[model samples]
Target: MVSAAYRRVNGGHDLAESNIVIYTHPTCEICVTVKMELDEQGKAYEEIDLAEFPERWSEVEELADGDRITPVTVENGEVTIGYHGIGCMFYD
Candidate 1:
């Protein structure tokens, strides 16, 4: 069963099952914006803050192919680094 928070955002879909993950940092404006967009779209995602979880920084680095950046979005095995004016690849 999907969690109550996940259900509220994704219409009863389990976010973990979807495998949507976002890598972010606390001071990044782009990260904040991307998070807002995700919330607005009602998409459930797992946000990993590098500041809070330093161990996950390597994961983001690998996903971004060594480019250390914030707001790295991963959805269903697809990785998107950086915000390009719109939302994540799975936004729509």
Candidate 2:
């Protein structure tokens, strides 16, 4: 069994059956780096351009507590604000 928090985020969306959401801009350097890593590791993810889906921006803001959230990486249900030191590993 998993903890309540873990269950809520679906184990950081690391579960094989879980789907990861990547909020990124194609021109973002950090997003590019993270995407490279994911590609190298053969990880699966779904990209949602914040520029295109402004509505989802509210969801991201809610999860991040209104922080300057970008390239928000979410696995399962867990939320990540940025892409500096953190990457897909948090979920893995």
Candidate 3:
């Protein structure tokens, strides 16, 4: 389940000034860690669980252009394929 702190912005909904979407699986430690980091930073993000909605896997793959990896992040219109800890920055 996604944390209530993060809002679910999808289907062309208008996002906040900072919009972030993360594709993750429940068992991925990296995914959990990254979400924690985002929470600590006071950043809100929408989390999509591939395990729950396997149909969304293609979205992540399209963002990666073939490489499918966990912890895939999309901020605004920019896509990041992996976690980069606290140093990771999302652009608008």
Candidate 4:
């Protein structure tokens, strides 16, 4: 059974199924790098282009703790504000 906190984070989202959600822009270098890494690992993801859906920026902001950072990723409800570089930069 999932913990209460995890369930709360899940919030009716299918992150329990391992679906990853990436908020990105096509021209974002860090976004590209993150996608490439995920591709190399054969991980599947759903990408939402902020450039195309400006309305979703608020959601990104929410996930990023009010920071307007690109490439906000939500995997199983774990929010990652930016690409976790090889040196562990830009990540929580």
Candidate 5:
């Protein structure tokens, strides 16, 4: 079972300015951690909980390029899967 979210953004920095969307679920601690980091950074993001919307799993797969990894951070088509992975820099 996999889940995810879609973020539609207008700006690139703040939640009030841009809409950073995170696809996540309550069971996914990684998802929680991702939100925490965003919160700590003072960056705002909208979270799509897959547990509530189960059909969005395909979206996560699509973003993950077929891998069913939750909490994948995507910005400007760049994808960072799992914690501390290369390429994406949502944590940094």
Candidate 6:
């Protein structure tokens, strides 16, 4: 189930300021590590467990150049695949 929960800003529905999605696998240690950082930073993001939705594989496939990986983070129109603390800087 690819469920998402987001908050509205300025009492309006503006996706530009409130769109963050995280694609992750349940057993990925890297995903857990990255999530911890996000939590510590007080960042609000939606996590999609691919393990529940096999159909979403196509979505990940469209982004994958060749290698298959989880914990794909998407903010705005930009995408950062894999978990790395360096990329977390972009959130700020």
Among these predictions, the greatest TM-score belongs to 3
Candidate 5, residues 35-75: lDDT per residue as tens digits? 77776777656666666776666777888777666787755
> Clash number for every model?
0, 1, 0, 0, 1, 0
Residue-wise lDDT of candidate 4 within 1-92, one digit each (tens)?
32222211222234443468877766678887777777777776767776776677778778767766777878776878786632112322
- Lowest lDDT sum, 10 consecutive residues, model 5, at 1-10
Task: Sort the predicted structures by lDDT, highest score first.
Answer: 3, 1, 4, 5, 6, 2
Q: Per-residue lDDT of 47-83 in model 1, one digit per residue for the tens?
A: 7767677666677668866666778888788888888
lDDT by residue for model 2 (8-52), tens: 222232335437677765456777666566666666676666556
Candidate-wise lDDT, in order = 0.66, 0.57, 0.71, 0.64, 0.61, 0.59
Ten-residue region with minimum lDDT total, candidate 1: 4-13
CA deviation > 4 Å runs, candidate 3? 1-4, 8-18, 85-92
Query: By TM-score, how accurate is candidate 4?
Result: 0.70
Q: How would the candidate models be sorted by TM-score, starting from the highest?
A: 3, 1, 4, 6, 5, 2
> Which scores higher on TM-score, 3 or 4?
3
Could you tell which candidate, 2 or 4, scores higher by lDDT?
A: 4
Assess candidate 6 and give its TM-score to the true structure: 0.67
Model 4 residue 18 distance off true place after TM-score fit, in angstroms: 6.1
TM-score preference between candidates 3 and 5, better one: 3
Candidate 6 lDDT over residue span 1-92, tens digit each: 21133331232224453467666767777777766776667677666666666556556556655435776777776887886533211110
Runs off by more than 4 Å, candidate 6: 1-18, 85-92
Clashing pairs for predicted structure model 4, backbone only: none
Model 3 C-alpha lDDT per residue in residues 9-66, reported as the tens digit of each score:
4533345544888888777788888888888888888878777777777787788766
What's the CA error at residue 29 for candidate 4, in Å?
Answer: 0.4
Clashes by residue pair, model 6: none
